[model samples]
Target: MNDSRFTPVDPVDLTARLVRCPSVTPVEGGALTLLTELLEPAGFECTRVDRNGTPNLFARWGRKGANRTFGFNGHTDVVPVGDAAAWTHDPFGGEIAEGYLWGRGATDMKSGVAAFAAAAVDFVRATPPDGAVVLTITGDEEGPSKDGTIALLDWMRTKGEAMSVCLVGEPTCPDRMGEMMKIGRRGSMSVTFQAQGVQGHSAYPHRARNPLHALVRLLDRLASEPLDHGTDHFDASTLAITTIDTGNSATNVIPARAMARVNIRFNDAHSSASIAQSLRDEADRVTAETGVTFELQVDVSGESFLTPPGDFVRLVTGAVTAETGVEPVLSTSGGTSDARFVKDHCPVVEFGLVGRTMHQVDERVSVDQIRQLKSIYSRILADYFA
Candidate 1:
């Protein structure tokens, strides 16, 4: 038996150390620091890429412009541990019991970051690849996301650092390991509408032009139809009317203003700009019919993107299948992740542990699965550089 496999980093130990860090979104929480300590000792050129007070780390294991660079992206910061009293184990304890490692970022991703970091460190030490290995870890993925990966990529551009291809270690499997990977993601955007009208006595409805009525009409128009049938690589676009309110407490008075917010997750069939134009046109149509003025504001989180199945996709799928013996399905069904940002820099796909428990109380991951993930990542590095 080869003792070398046990000589260096154990992904499970790294995961436990990370889970113990109190890094809730937008907080450094020492998670990045711990990772930097581990990587630097193993030969990674580590740099703290903090932006606008958001913590981020970028580490590379070889020359900057190696023939081909394989990049990794993940986040160490986690969502807040909601209702700590509701958990059976200490949320920050990183307990290894009952065959699972329990903690806040266990499934949602600290384990993922650890797995890849360990794999990168070990793979480089054991057999130096001709190409480079880069890891980008961020602390603001769970927050506004403006200063996290975006900041890293912006910095990379300014410094002329780039990856030939990138893999995001976000948990993409829903039911079990090796069952799924994300090939693309739907774009996300939000639109808020404010309507103005004349306020008057509710008793004589004819005397008042109620803004609430106009707002409701506008919302209905936006939500009344399907954005599209499912695309070849994505599900149909969806628009959800998240909120509508006027703050009116009196029954006898008609309010002069009302507001509503709608969120849309769109496929490659549309862009945020196109959707924004269509929505503004809808508001105009409603205003023409209702005689009320409307103001529309749009915020786009990310544009829809796809890394068409090719060599990169095949390499990832083959690795997961070889490790877990389950031929994985290529999917783009989940909510947004850092991959949405990585696609611009390089062709990116996501694979990792089962995420059924991500963001839930008592969130935990199987210990064996963590090791298995490390093996999978190790194999990917080997094959990509093979």
Candidate 2:
């Protein structure tokens, strides 16, 4: 049951192993095989669940009668490296130069996964915990996410797996590794508005109701005031008009309809339903003002959540302080992430290397940073389950 093959391994090698997999979203690319080959020999049972064509791996290793389980959630799939010519090195080079690993997904996530995998191997090799360590990695986080962790969690529920606290290895730090941990995230929703009007000649002002004029008023009302000043744990919600369309072929003719779309990054101050209601109210006011009728459609993606300053937060913060001498801030300020889906199932937090290069051309992570990240993750495990 000894997994010496994975033990005493360098994080740089682990990152190389992960980057070699061309596991773009929803593609296996042998990443799961690489993970299983390294983990199974360590007395861990690994299973690959292919739900709706997305590959997800769930592996666990520990004592038989373990009551507590710590789960690590992450994605193996990476965003496509657009414009390979723009990168100095091969997007999948996994090369080490200038103290950094050059490749796509190096910093966005693959580094974190590799570091955690190495640390898990080291942890079990040194002192096997009384509890189990479960890794839930999916290949759909970068895509639609319809078949990623969401489906895997459902499968876990059916199998009666007990997950106490989950930590996501997303690139959460802003400036430096261990500088921050994401305890919560803001909710996101998209809205589309369409106003109907009568088409007529531009000179016939009395003959046509201009829908563009009505949409302008509606947008002004939605944008003129702040959604909320700020919440205690979250910043103020924001609504931005992303697109406005009025297909008028001739300048002398008035369009029959107008369409607009807006995206809202909202805090706990509002729910998607409440935001939709606000849109409806504005539509009503516009109708009253100009006698124009319109339709509004709102798509609620996810809700906001906070983990609070608790044992999970303390476990990670203490580890960062001990390892890097940095007091990480617990912040909820960021765009949406798969952690949003995870927060619904368990108290989830995100911590990893700095994300200054995620989703960018020539994405890279420092070799030294990867090693330090492995140490940090190991310390987190020791502090939480020791």
Q: Against the unseen true structure, what C-alpha lDDT does each candidate score?
A: 0.92, 0.87
List runs of model 1 lying over 4 Å from the truth: 1-6
Candidate 1: worst-modelled 10 consecutive residues by lDDT = 1-10
Mind giving the per-residue lDDT tens digits that candidate 2 earns over 1-386? 44555537587887887887888887888888998998898778898878989999988887533687888888889999899999988888788888889888798788988888888878887778889988888999889888999887888878877577888999888988778889999999999999998888999967999999999999999999999988889999999999999987799988899999999999988888888898899799899999889998888778888888888899988998899999998899888778888887788999888989999998888898999988999998888887
lDDT of 1 by residue, 83-177 (tens): 99999899999999999999999987999999999999889988889999999999988999999999999999998888999999999888889
Best lDDT among the predictions, by candidate number: 1
* Per-candidate count of clashing residue pairs (backbone under 3 Å): 0, 0
TM-score of each: 0.98, 0.96
Model 2: lDDT equals 0.87
TM-score of 1: 0.98
